[model samples]
Target: MSIALPQLKSIKIDKFILSLFSAIIIAFLFPTGAGMLHLKQVTEIGIGFIFFFYGLKLSFTEVAQGLKNYKLHVLIQLSTFVLFPLILLGLKSFLIGLIGETFWIGLFFLAALPSTVSSSVVMVSLAKGNVPSAIFNASISGLIGAFVTPLWIGIIVSQSGGMSLGDVFLKLIIQILLPLVIGLLLNKKLGHIAKKNSSKIALYDKTIIVLIVYASFCTSILAHMFDGISFLNFVFLFSAVFCLFWLVIGIIYFISLKLNLSLADRITATFCGTKKSLVHASAMVNIIFANNVSASLFLLPVMLYHITQIVILAIVANRIGKRTLNEAA
Candidate 1:
């Protein structure tokens, strides 16, 4: 006789998610060891290559095809870069009082991030969404966020920390944008190879992300940055991230319905619009909050939201997939 695991036990968790939290725990326990200057150097180089590989994967033809749905694209992008930030802006005062200014700024930073690339596409595809549009939005959103995220943060975070807007932009250009352009330029030669090895490339991205997380957390713990955060504060931050996520999800659903979007388009909008890029968040934090004591605390909201979205969207996508399968039957 064969037996199946209980449904909850059977649910598959991404290994990378496990790796992410492991990195954090390790950072906390072995903070001194991982906080070496050499690890920092390796992390920077790894970040450049992450964006470089990302650019190599983007196909101009796919982007052109996706442009036909310009209205949908605009809506998703606005929801990503504008609506999310505005929601956080309105809640800033309250959140600051509850969690303090550092965490509040982190929340705002999370809102300003772009839609995730791989996970957004995977969720949309699983939900029987417009795969091409999802790919297009996810790809372009990162480039847009490279510029807009810094600008948004600059308006609030003063140059007092020696992190002027110009300094941030310079780092952005050097670390993220320049490598991306080089990769794009070489895409004709490398794109097919990159596509064929996409899984390997994704592994590289995940590895680098884990390294960055470990480094950030190590730095923060060593600096005693999280000493004041209580268990209640943790609960509040988790709740806040969940609510922010659902707010974007709800608004996107309403807009899709109002526009009479097809089921696929609706799914694409929902997944892409509501997600934030942890890759971009991790890479940007190195530059944006470099050497800052609270750098890891700044990552708290983004990291929590990242895990929350993946778990929630996986279930949602599976349900949508089942419903679509039934309709065909």
Candidate 2:
């Protein structure tokens, strides 16, 4: 079989966008109607690989490099795990009343999830930001999510009667934290091999992300995730989130400029600090939403934002990134 073919290892990460598009097309053409059961398991493995490769790809050096950007990292992490959630919490007083229970809960839970690591780095890179530091911020964000996400859920969901805080806390410590710790500790040896085969490692990454997306979509269909909202309502809600993203990135941009930071740093902080991870969000969904209808629906806002951010960031990253680099030249 050594014949003319597209080299898998040579395929750029960006091409995975087509893989995602293909998955979407396949689902639409078939409605997940036949023999898609295997996809669920495959997605599960993908998810596992996603986290595993995440561990593999990350290194002590990258982590040490992140420590130098503590101010930026803290701001991004706090914005993700704190500022945004608090904004949603404050808005809860009025927003929930207008949106109804399901939509409100979806919005609420969405706010509580951690900043995604790789995609944050990806988006930051697209925006011509400090890629390495963004990676650190994102990696730490996942570690933080192991605690922060569950804690937020526990405190927030108490009024909703979702689940016991302590039990969930214990489970998060065991399931989420343990693996990451093992990976980190083993990084010296495994990291080399993992980094060497980053291409294959990346397949694991995409597989996991796709699985999460598919599973969440499946959950949505199974649980009537789209219930009670019209196309108009989805439009409105998505707009609200879009504006929310704008407001966030906009604020970060101004603050960075005001602080007299370099354009590179500003772009880094803006993109890294502004968004949430859908992958981590999905992983933690069951904790927050449980059997709630909003668990599935919550995904819509993030997905919408993810796509929009990528497109806009790509344009901005390329334009400004070039100008900044040119100034140095």
Candidate 3:
């Protein structure tokens, strides 16, 4: 006799994405109390733990194996740190007019950030791609971005009389790099516990991210930093973010073909190279632009792009996975 099986339903919306928007909305309606609660200190401590857990879970063996694919690594890193920012720089004169100077800076901040570690690896694995390389690129991208992102932002912030470049680096070393190093040092003893409870850790991370978002928006809302922005401007911003995603995807696909990359490597490169980490963006914004009341403005593109990449890549990854399965059959 044949047996009936349950079919899985596709997820149309991510709960975490909804939570992000909700955080913004809550901040809008109730913009007070974040400061009174000392959320800055809370988020700062949370950011340290987030990176600590990130380092704890990172496997040295996987990183070593991923290093074998030097060409692929170089391609992904260059696309992330160089090509993305250069494209934005080239378009700055035109885009800055449309989005306004402040919002344009936000987009540049998004461009300068690193790949999302969890989603990149998950998508690559889903599409039957180079999982190890995705993990390596995603991890290393964040580390590289800790230095590189600030340099990119420094160019703009320096002009505006924001934090000095030296101060930025000093803060990053204390807040981000130091915690990461400590976690790595303890990895040999505590890595397994981190791996075992990764889901819980991820939930903790997301909670902290939501808290950061809420806190930032609260500050901005109270300051009326968004008063000048209009509905039309938001439409334009979303359109620009969408176009940026596909533009980078197209460029990466073309380059992958020209480089004669394997199907798996192509998938890894495209996915990893196009993604930007909201986690890193949230953490860095607080540290890098700490004194700026309009710091939440910088998160706009990062949040929008985070949603865009997740929704679009989920569909694309599933389609590619099905195609690979059919070909194997």
Candidate 4:
């Protein structure tokens, strides 16, 4: 008997999406939990674990071999680290009064972030896209962003009080680079095992992200972070984030078509190129914005963009998968 393939399900409202709202609600209702849990320390350790496992799962050999398609890689990297920021920067004058300066800074930070590792690969696989390329690009994007994000921010923000670029780099080294190096060194023996248990690792990744969201939002709530902002401001912020996501997706699709890429590569480029990493955003904010009262405001746009991209792309990926299956059959 032939083995049957797994059935693909259409996207719908799901618990994962609901959990995002739940995270915000819980944080708002019980701001004290953040302190009781010592979330700051937990988040620090969790951030390290996130990168460590990421390094463990990454195979440098596979990443190197996959880089043969230099054009696709370049397009994706530029879209993520360069073009996205430029677009926001171009619109900065228009956005300041509309969304206020603080939210604008948050939006800028969101654009500067790298493409996500887990969700990008998941979306590509679901769409029956270029899995290897997605994996390679997502993994490498983080490494590039670890340095590039701060450099971009430094040009725009001279200083956040006493926190300087030097301090940011120092924290990056201790928190991100050192742990990543340790994991990479450990990868020689542990890579295969980590790869084998990827599903479990993904669950771990999401759990840590949720914890970070709760902690960050809780702290913001305790400080009455959103009290000053009106409901209209949030509505406008959501709209801006929604527009940004679609605009990037459209650009990636058009560029892939222009370059005459393969279907798989096109899907990979569209999905991976358009993503911004919530993991990096959550981890980096604690270091970069250090002790800034408006830290939660910086996270607002990121959370909105992350949620929007996931929901929209999941539906798009499902449709693509169904069409591909029908074409094959």
Cα lDDT for residue 122, model 4? Answer: 89
Question: Which is the leading candidate under TM-score?
Answer: 3
Could you tell me every candidate's TM-score relative to the true structure?
0.95, 0.82, 0.96, 0.91
lDDT of each: 0.89, 0.67, 0.91, 0.87
Model 4: pairs clashing at backbone N, Cα or C within 3 Å: none
42 Cα displacement, candidate 3 (Å) = 0.3
Kindly indicate the candidate among 2 and 4 with the higher TM-score: 4
Q: Tell me how far the alpha carbon of residue 22 in candidate 2 is from the true structure, in angstroms, after superposition.
A: 6.7
To one decimal, what is the Cα RMSD in angstroms of model 1 from the true structure? 2.7
Q: When superposed on Cα atoms, how far off is each prediction in RMSD? A: 2.7, 6.9, 3.3, 4.3
**Residues 217-252 of candidate 3: C-alpha lDDT, one tens digit per residue:** 999999999898899999988988999999999999
Model 2's TM-score against the true structure: 0.82
Show the colliding residue pairs in model 1.
Answer: none
> Order of candidates by TM-score, top first?
3, 1, 4, 2
Tens-digit lDDT string for candidate 2 (1-329): 56765345632355555655565555445545423676545543444445656676677787778687666776778777887788788787676666655666667666777777666777677657788888788777777777887787678777677678887766555545556667767788789998888777656666666655555555556555555567877776777677778877877777777777766677778877776776676556644454454454666676666666666666666667667678879
Candidate 1, lDDT over the whole model:
0.89
Span of ten consecutive residues with least summed lDDT in model 3: 4-13
TM-score of model number 3: 0.96
Error of 3 at 123 (Å): 0.3
lDDT tens digits, residue span 110-167, model 4: 9999999888988999999988889889999999999999878877877554358898
Candidate 1, 1-329: lDDT as tens digits: 99955379647877888998999999888998664556799989999999899889888988777878987898899999999999988988898888788888999999989989888989898899999999899989988998999998888786445468888889999999999999899899999999999999988888888888899899899888888889999898888888898988999999999999888999999999999988899899999888887888989899999999989999999889879999999
